[model samples]
Target: MTNRVYVVGVGLTKFEKPGRRADWDYPAMALESGTKALADAGIAYDKVEQAYAGYCYGDSCSGHRAVYGLGMTGIPVFNVNSNCSTGSSAMFLAAQAIRSGMADCTLAIGFEKMQPGSLGSTFDDREPPMQRHLLAMAELREIAFPPAPWMFGAAGLEHNEKYGSTPEHFVKIAAKNHRHSVHNPYAQFQDDYTEDQIKADKMVYAAAGLTRPMCSPTSDGSGAAILASERFVEDNDLAGQAIEIVGQSLVTDLPGTLDSASLITLVGADMSRTAAQRVYEQAQLGPEDIDVIELHDCFAPNELLTYEALGLAGEGEAHKLVDAGDTTYGGRWVVNPSGGLISKGHPLGATGLAQTAELTWQLRGLADKRQVAGAKVALAHNIGLGGSVVVTAYRPAER
Candidate 1:
């Protein structure tokens, strides 16, 4: 990085099932989270030299509408949409602004008010963005269930077949995250579903025996993070609480992404793997150095597969880690203490920033009930299926 970037403040609104809260527009969600983030940073909106707003399902300049509620500061407000990686991608831009000496302070905010149920393409009139991905899956298996669940579930099934992982292993991940959610105020589902309950819930993908608990719920929420340069943090006396973003990388689909030969690749494991490798390389740290993680657990299977992708576990050995209880507290790494997307709710645009907020708290020792003891190094992974993946490493800033 040309300059160091530090996250001085982060904020989130409670995630809720879409439409469950009436008149809860994205604008209001944006205002609430944005205000809280500014307050946490001890700065005003005018201090932000630029802003990036991320949302997947919105009209043009939705970013302007959202940030105007914070202030009509007339900073360069850019709208970003990169599927589910939208939030982190926005953060990527803000961090770059600071890294390149273009800005001292910047804001990246994300908000989503999604329709309930499985996700689908917004435009039926034109070619869907995921047409190629779906075609890849088509060559491997018949498309039978909801597009989102089937895609993720098929990837899990592939892992199962290749590695002898049982449905129990996948359900176990869901159980752990749901249990974690009981302590998260922002989680949409705090029900501590047992492994048995997760296994027995109505199966969404019959082949993989994936139940509803194994999938991320569509939600309405917003999150915001403020980034500043080292000089800005020092000048503002924010080092005590700031989290240094040691390394960050955003990667999209590689050339072989559509092969579908490995359903793992079909669902973005390679993108995640490549991105994480770059992040680890830049941070001069590896999986063993990471004290905590908040990976993209959009589906329980993805969480398991991601273990290998993120280098937290060896290939075909993720189930072993789950079996040994290595993904939670008192393990090698405490992954997703925020309940993750599995229980935390996934408001597409807001999910990445929500993950960032959780890790920030963990590093700052401010995560209350979900705190990872003495968390010093944290890694965050968020991937979107048209295939954008972002991996970030963070450590506490010292005065």
Candidate 2:
């Protein structure tokens, strides 16, 4: 029989502003999150045959620092940095290890201790990784804002020009995410915001119709997950608590990203679509099959663009889905039940695993107030610039 993988345990640190908890460094965050995952799994760290650590702003061999404190086991530890997708990429690797029978159990950890401010390049000596993307973005809109907001804002503007979506659509998505965060104790900004509040909350990039609240904050936090093969789960009596990873796909930018001059494409929209399609095909599922989602909402525009890309809506019809309240609770599919990056805090490394944690809770009926009732199938989409997108589908292991 082919190997089946399951996420037996997941844990997350409450996301906070960079300086809010000065004592919680990357290692601290990783240890807390990692140990919690091990405890949740009812297993010891030595059981983990391999480990992958994801971080964007840390030094080399940081994975060792994170895992060594948990156990001195000399298992292979791989450090990963794929910008925002760092966490999910690590998760993908861990799943591969189990699926390939390389290991019966593997750990994936992601954490980031960010500096307070808009995110910037850590290394100025080398050419910036996003330079080409920014250059392509400059051709579409004036480079007035910071790199991330500018690119996403331009994409929002293009959506308005191409489709009939208005600035209110983006504002509504921000409002929804902010409101969703109120129920997520782990979210950094758990307070709700009205559309007016979001619109008036200091325009970070006015030309692109982006307000401060619509952008994800720079956060310091960590998340970790333990993945095991079916044999490991059955042997260790973890079946009842496990959540199976049904399908997953990772895709990067194609040539059209630069040559097409589409801001949406420039922001990894095509990659998201490609990845989502692959996952759906692999799982024999469609957008309608999913009951909940935790998409990469690093910016409000990206969330809206992902609606169409993930097949939640048709081309140029995402606004209608937003208008009809299909992306929220009591709708067809509850998106960003974890408050997403906007409110949940986007610690670059922690985000993807956090998404996995949220879905695991939703699938297991562990999410208290944020739970999507009768949730059976869930989907997660995480994207990073330069650019890589990972889309994964999940179902309860018992099912």
Candidate 3:
């Protein structure tokens, strides 16, 4: 039988624009988050049996170098990259290590040192992993210079066309996230804006109804998590703080992921839906059971889309969920309490683990001013475009 895995500790560095921090390299970022996680776990680095490091833009074995600073006990060190889902992928492996009884303790860390501006492939000599979506983009719409906004924006517009929602719904989600960030010390942007401000901001893609404020900005940050088997938690007397990983699922691209006939599928919403469904099934919990959510709001549209994907709303009903005020404080679910990727900054590799950290805090009632009242269960959704989606569920460990 698989053992239950508990997150004993988690740490996150405040997300910031790229180049804002001098001397903040991936290795440095890793150490900061790693040490914090270890301290939170009340454990020593020597207790960690294996480590996984996740990042998108880095050389091979950067995981080795990044995590090596955490006191080289000669454990297995893995470098993991799964597009933007890198962070959660690392956490998945760590949880699996414990769940399978292979290791009692594991460390998962993710960090990104991104370049400024919209994301583009660093290599020109290779067939891009996301070229499938690019091909669909060319067929479906004029290729925008920064294709991310166009793809997501067009997807938002598609939802609007098919579901009778408006871009205003997406901007409202962004504004809500920005308002949430005002209480998040670790978020990149604390400057709150109204839905009108977000809609009227500098346009990123007109068709998608995305403006500067509606999109996640590139950022530099790090996040780390330490997971332990239930036995290990008991032995270490960490029951007071440990949070159980109730269930998690990682899903990759399936049919219609890059369909040219429908632009909405271009952002891989179907995979997110599938993954969330599986996690809910495994956890024996539905979206209704989740009191808080830390979703991959890489763009405002994605947030609205995820509300439906995660079953917080029915088909074509995400906007209605927004109108009902069910996604914020005093609602059915407090989504993105850490401000989410929209305002929290998207540091590719670090994004997922950061979500993990946020949910862990929420479940433990340690989210400070952004805390969701009586948050007993939480969920995290992180996705990458090349593409992968990981959905995780969490609850506080039993005493």
Candidate 4:
């Protein structure tokens, strides 16, 4: 547990808009990013002793096919699928392998080509007649929240009611993220949006306003990172070339134990906080020590809640932080400088890896226009269904 591991290099393909047909297959994207990561690390593919590939809906043997495309030198490749956190989980597994002396170098790759339309099917089974009926009822209720006229309900309504967050507040998130996306060449939606435009958008879900609910569009992309132990890094003279993995922590929700009455206390939020605290302890750092962050913004409200959960802001005070511009670049701490799942586009399995890639770039001082000034410590947070959570902390070599 005390062993140190570092991310030698990171690579990511551009996230595309929903419904846009991809020119490259999943494996092709994986190989492309993997090759780029290896080159970025100044290491040959043959030097990668092990590989971990994460993909939620790729065809079978996807990992082997991708690695074979790079170079047919047989290496142990394990495919992982853990919903949205697949990529971070894969990276964690790879780091563990290297730290345990099972491998000198490891490659973790994540890819996804999500289909257009709603993601309801991806959440759970829709086969059983009773289940489908229940889902339909739930969907109907979600569409009629706040007694219909108010245009809000459930989680979004509750969040607003408690924190005095208006639809305009949510629009601010969209505006800020879109602005950030202008600097991220790999982001799907680089076009900027004004608050007026965000306010005018049509609503999607009842409680969740249009400006917030439509955060994640379907995306097709891939990303990869290479990890090596500190011993391996020193032996290979990689002192000034790696982003150190200062800490990693994971937590899962207790099924059927979530507080159903209060919409704010999501099981995932608690799980994420627990993991973040553990990571901070392991890294010997506090929330103030984090210069940059990439968090799961599956929805705008999710990001707001994350601030409180991560202790970056007090309970029901996340809106104040956003209003103060503390979450933006050059602020107290930059959150989701890569445009997040909002404008960056969430490709499910690829999202966790994409977050890591952004952090790696920031820590290396290579984030270009979107870079957080003087960033030395970075954190990436990802959550999956049933409240699976992972938080990773990184420190630049200069630190």
State each model's CA lDDT, in order. 0.93, 0.93, 0.90, 0.77
What would the per-residue lDDT of candidate 4 be over residues 173-292, giving only the tens digit for each residue?
778788888999999888888888876776655455654334667688889999988877888777787998888987776443252445444325777788899999999999999999
What would the per-residue lDDT of candidate 3 be over residues 85-120, giving only the tens digit for each residue?
999999999899999899999999999999998998
Summarize candidate 2's per-residue lDDT along 14-41 as a digit string, tens digits: 9999989867778889999999999999
Give each prediction's root-mean-square deviation over alpha carbons: 0.9, 0.9, 1.2, 3.8
Candidate 2 whole-model C-alpha lDDT, 0 to 1: 0.93
Model 2 clashing residue pairs (backbone): none
Where's the lowest-lDDT run of ten residues in candidate 2? 252-261
Error of 4 at 297 (Å): 0.9
Error of 2 at 174 (Å): 0.6
Model 4 residue pairs with clashes: 153-207
Q: Which residue pairs of candidate 1 clash?
A: none
At residue 143, give the lDDT of candidate 4.
37
Tell me model 3's lDDT, rounded to 2 decimals.
Answer: 0.90
Residue 51, candidate 3: how far off, in angstroms?
Answer: 0.4
Q: Give candidate 1's TM-score.
A: 0.99
Superposed by TM-score, candidate 1 places the C-alpha of residue 373 at a distance from the truth, in angstroms, of 0.7
How well does candidate 4 match the true structure in TM-score terms? 0.90
